[model samples]
Target chain A: MAFRYPDGRKFEPKRNEMTKKSVNKDARFSNRGMTLEEDINETNEYYLAHQVAVIHKKPTPLQIVNVHYPSRSAAVVTEAYFQKPSTTDYNGVYKGRHIDFEAKETKNKLSFPFKNFHDHQVEHMKRVLDQGGIAFAILRFSYTDEVFLLEATHLIRFYEERDHTRKSMKKKDIEHFGYLIPLGFHPRIDYLKIVDKLITGS
Target chain B: MAFRYPDGRKFEPKRNEMTKKSVNKDARFSNRGMTLEEDINETNEYYLAHQVAVIHKKPTPLQIVNVHYPSRSAAVVTEAYFQKPSTTDYNGVYKGRHIDFEAKETKNKLSFPFKNFHDHQVEHMKRVLDQGGIAFAILRFSYTDEVFLLEATHLIRFYEERDHTRKSMKKKDIEHFGYLIPLGFHPRIDYLKIVDKLITGS
Candidate 1:
């Protein structure tokens, strides 16, 4: 049995790869060329090894339709599909506190679009908070290489406000309310620092 | 793209069917009359819906080697294999407490072979206990329709004593130390009662 995608596996080609990167008005904020998912995963690895926290990205659920048995020792997956919208992107325990969060990156320099947040995820975060869990999001302005930890309570407020207007969250709003985390090398994103501040106000 | 397997699809013969019932010494236990994996899954669902706990069975990690895109809506998994032994069978949160456990069912009426458990799982449970998390096992004596929630500390003691003339824990020994949870319709197995006892001894 194997735990990872078998070697030589290939992903489906990007559907809109032909479209060029959007040109933004702010010339100073060139989009950083790092995948948010990869960075967060690496940081989680560092956290686990250091015995700090144990956060993990939930596997993208797949519905397996058909499998074939070639030999007694192994079987091959014949078909599968993504399951559905997930409750949250990441979840685990941190110092006995239940930790849950989602990550989103936006290319827009001036605003973080509300569309990047999903309704169900918002609802799930609300429930987590109600259950006394620490819930939040890591919003990254890809254009500026900036990452901010926004409390779910604040995000819920923005989510509720979406009904009256279609406006995205202005960059200044997050700057004022969220904890701006400086990017680092070892734990790439030192999110626990923000978590400590959120829980302890330190 | 569909996230679920296509409707009305099935796997090969050998991979589909597993023994579902055990009978020994006038005691009979149903495998939930389903797969071991499915039972744990349903139990977790029962646990979550009742707000009694939040436990999840981690997806079995697999290595995918090939996928056939028969259509845009469906991706057929062509080759995959199970990975290495897992650390634990189930994990999640319960009343702000980190919960970790493994579920195992044995057919033998006289004794459950120690080999049913992996070394990694034992180690994982120990680690969780060291970190102040609750760790245990849902051991189903399939021959007797009995399930016990045995604390990891007790199990660890038994595990280490294996070389010192204790081959496997006797059924009576487990009954004396573990909490036998009568399966119910909702929350399936109410292990939390045992947890309450563990926490307060009341």
Candidate 2:
């Protein structure tokens, strides 16, 4: 359904309320039912609270076409169409370095498909990398319950070199070139630890 | 009336067409009839083309509620509402530095009101600054056709100290603390020049 709502005034004013009801129950309940997006958002919250970093997910872009104003105070979007994002989903700063990345979850057991990433996103990552910013991808294998932080350079390489026969990035190749993000309780996807390594090149 | 569409499929898929037709008639026509948003976008485009910087204005945030899939390939949002953004509008990397800011146009020539900035955006800017990113506000005085790049620290100082009957930052005060961004031909708002000075702290 492209993740839109059905009807009603569902304008959520969540500054810190996206996961306000979903978290702080217990550490064991970490990511029990949350999607990759939700988990990363929660992780970002934790980071913000601790002053660790300031990264944010860019909102889904929409080409708004129709609006119905019921009152002077509130505006309701009656019709809008999804637009292909020109860049990655997430970006921000950490320790004076620019951070940018895209998150994708795959149910496939052996590989992550190249179809998951758009060409412009790859190009955008390359540009970010060129500007001396940190660019990467967070790949989550749902079937195996594993996650890896792969640098954008490698992702771009796999993307550009993909042919009809090799439509997907192999799991082994991913593991070879990426760092397995440690699953944690507070921040579900602790990818910044890997990012720290990338920044210092340690 | 809140900048949503009126009717039809007005999905402008303009990766490069935002100012494609409006610009390049001549250098004298530079920002002759464009809005602040359009001008900044064109400037960012110029930056990208010149490999000068990689900056982007974040899309307006909305809480989409309902979507209809007319076909397997196309999904349309039939219901949604505007959500207050928790962060600033623009953020990116330039010269290996994390850059973040909010662009605002004021009709008032005497002062730029604190009302233009939301509480969350101010907090977000503060967080960005704390993370060692360069944060500022691009203030365009539409009445006078002048623009200024005001740093976050000074903006924050004015914001935090704002009180009853003194709800604005004066133009004189802004001129003292902010850099006057030059209006250019190719890039309508040449902000990175001031940013370069900021980076060197000269």
Candidate 3:
């Protein structure tokens, strides 16, 4: 079943919320079971609390068609359609630097699928880069428990080369081109550390 | 009846074909008699194409509960609920500065109602201003066909004073403190001009 909102629109607020609920206690107990999205959200909260940065995930857009007003104070969405997002998953500012990125998780144990990313996303990243903004992606190999912060420039290169080659990028490829992000407790995923490295290296 | 995605998932692919439907006889008719949301979307496209800025309305979050899969390829949403937004409606980058604003429309001919603005949104704008980002609200008086870009600082002042003084800001105060942005043909609402003025004034 699809989700409906207070205004009668169809869009799932959070795809992993129910699963998160189920494993919430277990996660709290074992310190193991946090989804990529949840961890990123938590990390963002931590960043905000520490006055470090202000990053946010763009919500999934929905085109509401039908609305049910049960009373003067209540408006429930009865019918709505989902809309495709044009930009990246997350964006914000960090110490005066504009930051933008998309997060993706793969179950692949050996290599990440190039097909996981859309062409428009690559184009968007390119535009962000051209306009002098930091653009990158956080890739998580779910099965292997590995996380890598791949710069948008490297992703763009792989994207450009895809027309010539139809194969997925090997683990070694990302390991060489991307910075390995060590997960911590406060900001569970410390992507800014890698960002600091990138800015300093440049 | 509520609309559902093909696969009964919460997400529906964007209707790319609908964009083709927008192109009409007159270049000014690009909005194509769509809803206010569609019109704003078209305006955002124009803004992006002209390299003016990258403003986008954040999507409404929905918490879907049940979905019915009528067929292998078709999904029908059965139940869901709306979630309160934590941030402003629109945010983007412009000329190396981060710009964040909310757009609101009112039918009242006298004054833009204070109820149109939310407490959290005002708080968000205050933080944005403190962080050195340009924050404001675009108020469209639909009855008079007039639009005004009011700075967040002005809004914060009015809002803070509301506890001891008047409940709402008069139209005259808005006219004095806000920049009147005449509705245009190409961008429909040329806010960049006001932004330029704000930057220059600072």
Q: Report the lDDT of model 2 for residue B25.
A: 51
RMSD to truth, every model: 8.9, 6.3, 6.5
lDDT of 2 by residue, B1-202 (tens): 2332333212222223222353445643545556677788989999998999899988766776666766555666787766677899898899789999998888897999887788899999999989999999999999888999999999999999999989999999999999999887888899999998998883
lDDT of 3 by residue, A1-202 (tens): 3444444433334545332343446565443676688888888888877877778898765555544545444345565555545788898777656788998878888788876676777888877786667889899998877899999998889878875456567778899999889988877898998988887887
| Residue pairs that clash (backbone atoms under 3 angstroms), model 2 | A4-B65, A4-B66, A5-B64, A5-B65, A5-B66, A6-B65, A6-B66
TM-score of each: 0.76, 0.88, 0.82
- Model 1 docking grade: incorrect
Q: Which predicted model would earn the best TM-score?
A: 2
For candidate 1, give the lDDT.
Answer: 0.68
Model 3 residue A91 CA deviation (Å) reads: 1.7
lDDT of 2: 0.81
**For all the predictions, what are the DockQ values?**
0.21, 0.37, 0.19
> lDDT: which candidate is best?
2
Q: In order, what lDDT does every prediction score?
A: 0.68, 0.81, 0.71
Fraction of real interface contacts that model 2 preserves: 0.55
lDDT of candidate 2 over A63-134, digit per residue (tens): 776667775556677877666779998999999999999998888999999877888899999999999899
Point out where model 3 deviates above 4 Å.
A1-24, A28-30, A71-73, A163-167, A200-202, B1-39
Please report how far candidate 2 places residue A91 from its true position, in Å: 0.5
Going through the candidates in order, the fraction of native interface contacts each one reproduces equals 0.19, 0.55, 0.14
Interface RMSD in angstroms for candidate 3: 9.5
